[model samples]
Target chain A: EAAVTQSPRNKVAVTGGKVTLSCNQTNNHNNMYWYRQDTGHGLRLIHYSYGAGSTEKGDIPDGYKASRPSQENFSLILELATPSQTSVYFCASGDAGRSSYEQYFGPGTRLTVL
Target chain B: AQSVTQPDARVTVSEGASLQLRCKYSYSGTPYLFWYVQYPRQGLQLLLKYYSGDPVVQGVNGFEAEFIKSNSSFHLRKASVHWSDSAVYFCAVSVGSTGNYKYVFGAGTRLKVIA
Candidate 1:
């Protein structure tokens, strides 16, 4: 079955520390996205990739950076983590065309920055 | 700019009762609409989506949504609710024919089913 997975389901980091979150997708989709879910605010996109070596800033990309080293792997990096950045992160994968825009999501990663 | 709105912040219903979650979108042009459910400590899963064709679309777990273009609303409903149905429901929107449109999601409505 097509699936998306994220590692380090729970993490606690100090402010100004470097944090990396990883995701893998077996869906073989061309598009991948990283979103943060917060209370009273819905899922907001941080960054996305069209494919390998392609990363694009999303709605809220100020404090985050993303890397797509390969077709199946995408990583979100926080160079200087902050308490405000603590939230549940979700990674998703979708197909290329408009007809296949529906995305599949990972289990989600809980990050807490002290 | 495109946006999605889920008016109710929370809803509580008794088990075996009916359920309806309201969702509205603000997009002048035709758009894709979807309903996603998130269980406690879990990620979101698609419940149903409406692009074209029938105003109503059926999804997993006996869920369904009706797209009313005139009102710009896509409301999800279920005839009978179970305790397991308690979760957060989010409504999202995007351009249907565009390949790069990022989905805009609503704040989400937390549904509580009391036994």
Candidate 2:
């Protein structure tokens, strides 16, 4: 079983506040992703990293930034949090060497921006 | 643009009843289809995947999905439903090159199994 864990499972922040969500994976997967889940939007990718120190923008990366400091850790940062940015965030890791292209996800973090 | 669509946002079924959740995709090239289930307050779990060869793929906990190329649909089905099976199900499509693959997910279907 691939293991992915997230920190600060629940967070509350005010507008203009900076927030960071951390994720750690033990699967040794090279690909890590950050996504936000909303009521009708499902999961929208915000940022992804192919490996350590390589972060790429995804579909909805405007208000979010990602950092992959090491192979086991990834973080999503919100420079200036807004109420609109309030959503459940998920982190996922995938191994490109695998044929299935399956991603293992972490228990999401629920963020509330007031 | 490539996209995945799950028409039903919510589904209600009684225990022991059959189940089916519809999913459709719009893509030009061959697609890698997947069905994932998210339990309450938990991460998404891979239920099944269809890359090639088999149109019908079996997943964990008696769940299965079938890929129909003609309709661009990959509908998940279960022979018998259980109360514990209630969860949000997502359909996704893998696109892009092998190393640079990106997944496009649907809005998801929230299933409610009543005993």
Candidate 3:
């Protein structure tokens, strides 16, 4: 089955520390996305990539950076972790050319910045 | 700008009862609407989507959604909901001429199914 897996299913980081959340997709899809879920906001897009070496900012990209080094891998980087950045992060893969279709999601990584 | 709205923050229904979750969208051109469900502590999963063609689209778990172009609404409905059907539902809209587009999601509606 098509799958998107994220590393560190749960993580707790100290404030001001650096954190990296990794994601890998076995479907080899061209589109990869990073989203953060929180109460009352649902899932908010943080960053997305059309393909390898192409990362784009989404609606909320203030404190996050994304990297898509290859078609099957995408990573979300937090240069400096903050309490506000703590949330459940999800990685998804899909076809960018067909945006009207569904995007498969990973289990999600729950991060808590103290 | 494209936006989605799910007015109710929460809804409670008894098992085996009919269910409906409201969703509305705002877009200039023809919009691509979708409904996704996320169970507790799980990732979001696609329930149904509306692009064109038939207004009513059937999805998994006996869930279906109808696209009302006039009202810019794509409401999800189920004939009978089970206990496992309880989840948070999200409505999203994609705006753009081509199929490749970014989706804007609503705050979401949490549904509770009673036994």
Candidate 4:
């Protein structure tokens, strides 16, 4: 079955610390995305990549960076963690061409910046 | 640009009762609409989607949604909701990816199915 896995299901980091959340997908999809879910806001896009080595900013990309080294791997990087950045983050993969359809989501990672 | 609105923030229904969740979207052109369900402490899963052809799209767990172009609405319905149906439902719009198209999600509606 298609799979999207995220590392560090839960993490607590000190403020100003750098954190990296990793994601891997076996779907072989060309598009990968990062989104943050917060109370009342649902989920907002942070960054996305059309293919390996092509990352793009999303609606809420400030303070967040994304890397897609290969079709099956994508990573979200927090240069400097902040309390406000603590939230549940999800990774997803999908097709980017016209045939692009539904996205398959990962289990998600919960981060805490104290 | 595309946007979605889920007017109701929460809804409660008794087990075996019928339920409907409203979702409205705004986009200049035709869009691909989808409904996702997120169970407690889990990731979001696609329940149903609508691109074209049929207005009513059937989904898993006896859930279906109808697309009303006139109102730009795609409302999800279930003939009989089970206790396990309690989850958060999100409505999203696909704005196309030619120019960094992004999926815009609604605030989401939390459903509570009373046993």
Q: Which number leads on TM-score?
A: 2
Question: Could you give the interface RMSD of each candidate, to one decimal?
Answer: 1.3, 0.8, 1.9, 1.9
CAPRI-wise, candidate 4 is: medium
C-alpha TM-score for every candidate = 0.96, 0.97, 0.96, 0.96
Tens digit of per-residue lDDT, candidate 4, span B1-115: 5789999999999999999999999999778999999998899999999989999999999999999999999999999999999999999998765535568899999999998
Native contacts recovered by model 3: 0.61
- The fraction of reference interface contacts (C-alpha pairs within 8 A across chains A and B) present in each candidate is 0.61, 0.73, 0.61, 0.54
| Location of the lowest summed lDDT over 10 successive residues in candidate 1 chain A | A94-103
Write down the worst ten-residue block by lDDT for model 2 chain A: A93-102
Model 2 segments more than 4 A misplaced: none
- Give stretches of model 3 more than 4 Å off: A96-100, B97-100
* lDDT score of residue A110 within candidate 1: 99
Q: Compute the interface RMSD for candidate 3.
A: 1.9
Angstrom error of the Cα, residue A68, model 2: value is 1.4
Please give the range of 10 consecutive residues that has the lowest summed lDDT in model 3 chain B.
B94-103
Better of 2 and 3 by TM-score: 2
Q: If you assessed candidate 2 against the hidden native complex, which CAPRI class would it receive?
A: high
Query: For residues A2-103, could you state the per-residue lDDT of candidate 4 as single tens digits?
Result: 789999999999999999999999988888899999989999999998889999999999999999999899999999999999999999988745335788
- For every model in order, what is the number of clashing pairs? 0, 0, 0, 0
Which lDDT tens digits does candidate 1 get at residues B24-79?
Answer: 99987777888999999998999998879999999999999999988999999999
Arrange candidates by TM-score, highest first: which order? 2, 4, 1, 3
Model 4 chain B weakest lDDT span, ten residues long: B94-103
